[model samples]
Target: MRDAEISSWRQWVTGLMVAGLVIGTAGGPLVGQETDDAEEGPQQVIIERTPVQLRDPKTYSVSLSLEPIREIDLVAVADGVTGAVQVQLGGAASRQAEAVRLDSAERQLELERAKALFRVAQAEQRATSGGDANAVEAAEGRLEAARAELRLAEHRLDATVVRFPFDGKVMGVHVVPGQFVRAGQPLVTLADTSKMRVAIPVDRTAVNEGDTVDIKIETDTVQAKVETIVPLKAEFEPLRELFVSVATAVLVLENGDGKLKAGQTVFADMIPRQPVMEVPTSTLANMEEGGRKVQVIRDGFVRDIPVKLLGQVGEEHVFVSGRFSAADELVLSSSEVLLDGARAVPAGAEIPTEEDEGAGPAGRRRGSRF
Candidate 1:
């Protein structure tokens, strides 16, 4: 009986061992199946994207003060009493037009006297043509003296009238009729308003001389060209040392309509010198290391592209530079964390077409999942 029991116990132990082996083999496949399920699919994120291109340089609106291209105070050339003021304040004057005239009765009489003396000297020189050599030389000298006196008298008479140097508007009249005025005294203030100038402080790298740009004055928009760029004075050396890009640029604009005025405020559009890309301001993300970044879709996966934040274009858009292609699909926004190489899709139900992507910023449509 003991032998039979011992034999049965051994058989029972053998069966238990076989059952354990079977259970272990089945569990091994289950664990591998769990791992396969976990690794089967990539995380999906909802994203909005737009196609990017090397767009035109970004424009910045800078405030500027309009001033006349030329301004001058017409001064009296000769000392005299005011005879007449031909131009009124705010009146237009043509080039070389008489703007003021000083009293010249005495000068006119002097000119007539000099002319009579010159004529008498001419007659005397002719009468002495065949006379003694000493007498003829004396007559010739008298004729030359009288001629020079006549010229001087004519010049004095001409100096009595103040003429407009150019086509301009009389901004001020400092002399009145019958008012005693002295030489080198201001008689009129004239300004040429046919063209306007604006001296604006700008970034040295952004603007250059002779570049055409747009300017906005109230509701009117006009084109202007950069005339010159002046560096900051030595007193601003500290500013320059701190900010090397500071500079002053002078812009010239046509104002034939006289819409722009001196001391009037206007706006100038300044363009960046470097090529840049346009993206929504919300698309920029800060990097853990430093600087900023934007995401792009490549090969159905999300990838982070390092970008330099140039500046904002407007309220909604910003300009950035990066090693990117015109064909790149810039991810506008993402609902989930976009890890490098992670699979992504559009947030909406339908994927955008190539033509839709080219439709510009307004045509970009957001989808449900990416």
Candidate 2:
């Protein structure tokens, strides 16, 4: 009876061991499935960013005060001038000088004759030293006096007729014709508006001396070329401090059409022609070294593209350029943390097209708000 009981106990133990092996094998598939699911990672969706070719011009709206190319103050150059307005151009007042005793042309002829006679006498004196040298010297002295008188007469004639110095409009008339005026008296104020200039504050980096700009005065718009950019002087520091938002650059543009007038308020717009890439300002990430960078979604992976900051465009957009093609996909808004080599799937977000933004054929569009 003892031997049978021991044999039964051993069989019971073998049965328990077999059952444990089967249970362990069945749990293997379930644990493996859970591990596979964890490895699949969380759901992530990447949206396509609207890739804009910043080929359009970056424009700025700035109020400018127009100024003339030159402002001249015409004054009476001679004494005893008639204030009687003679040749009036652009509403300026001027008058011919009082009548001269001798005609300028006649005086010129007389001076030439006197010079010729003096030369002949000088030759004669040289040829015969003793032939009444004192008398010849006296004749030459009289001829010299006549020549001096001719010059004075010619000068007086010139002083009679007032000539306008440049093509411009007269801003003020200080004297009238027929009125006797003294030397150094103010005549008229002239402004050369054929070409106008405006001191436009601009970003020193964005503009150049030769760039072209559009100037709008009242209802007229004209193309003007940048003539020069005046450097900010210490004298203007007070003005700069007052206008803290404005730059110190002074833009001088050519307005040859005279459409722009001095003291007239105008709007100056500068457009750039070079091509660039436009991106939302939010996508930019600050670099550790310096400058800015952005994350690009390409081939289901993220790439950190180094971009050049080309200034801001619209309210929320910025112009940037570097290693990017028109077809390259940029991540606009992403659900997952943007990481290098991270797997991503496009969320099928609609990207804005050029047509929606009213971008012209050349991608021309309006610029910033301020």
Off by over 4 Å in 1: 1-64, 216-221, 233-242, 267-370
Q: Looking at candidate 2, what is the lDDT of residue 224?
A: 61
The candidate scoring highest on lDDT is: 1
Model 2 Cα lDDT, one tens digit per residue, 18-63: 3321000111221122445544323333243434343422222234
TM-score of candidate 1 versus the correct structure, residues matched by position: 0.55
* TM-scores vs. true structure, each candidate: 0.55, 0.42
- How does each model score on lDDT? 0.69, 0.53
Candidate number with greatest TM-score: 1
